[model samples]
Target: MAQREAFAGIMLENENMTIAPGAAEDDRLDYFVHKDGLTFAGTHLIIDLWGGEGLNDADLIETTLRRAIDVAGATLLHFHIHAFEPDGLSGVAVLAESHISFHSWPERDYMALDIFMCGKTDPYKAIPILREAFKPETLQLNEIKRGIVS
Candidate 1:
């Protein structure tokens, strides 16, 4: 009876495992261990960046947005920029593979940048690059993950 129980236990363990080391085995291993293709549901970031010297240039804002799209491999569907009396503001929304976005307020030496991307995209890279380009005296960054119920 003891030998029979041991054999049954071994059979059960093997039954839960795969026989071949093919795609199915790989998938099983991934499901049991690796998290390679796993991704976040979505990410929303609202950034209030303040600048000091020459950060309010319209050219700079345009260049930064264009460069960001290139670097992130994002798609720019539409953009709206307004330069007010005291300061200028530029807002752009890009339709990216990960998600959508908004960037604005470069006239008053301040800009607000909001980015939302789902799946496999990296929005964090934009922050350090923008910090260097804008040279803000003070900055505020807010990040919120959206649509992550499961």
Candidate 2:
């Protein structure tokens, strides 16, 4: 006997809905949307920040996460953060409705961030918050819309 498929939809049928390999994951967050006949679809953002003071490791990470949640319209559920004191390398995964995650490093003055949001959640709004949080001398961002093949 063959296993039967559960949900049916172009969004789920496509590889677009699946999260990328080696990407950040947040087990605490589970997004559910049932409206407009569309469910389990959303956007993800990857941000790279450069140029910030190397001394203040804890402050930058805390401030960045808070701003991303409060301003980006992302509902943070839970998070895990690891930082290298001398090198100023920080990694964080923020469990959220849109999705989870952001990272920062004060020593090298660099960071990589990813934010995923579904349903009515808007990820772009978080930009200003990030801008204020990192105050990077140079910032590069990549946005990917996750849903549907066609």
Give one clash count per candidate, in the order shown.
Answer: 2, 4
Q: Candidate 1 has what TM-score?
A: 0.60
Query: Per-residue CA lDDT of candidate 2, range 1-150, in tens?
Result: 122233322233355244323324555344544444655456678878778443246666666666666665666765665665455544454444655554555556677778777755667887877777657787787866566333
Candidate 2 Cα lDDT to native = 0.60
**Per-residue alpha-carbon lDDT of model 1 for 43-100, expressed as tens digits?**
6678887764444466777677667655655667665555655665555555534443
lDDT of each candidate versus the true structure = 0.58, 0.60
Q: What is the lDDT of residue 118 in candidate 1?
A: 52
Top candidate on TM-score is 2
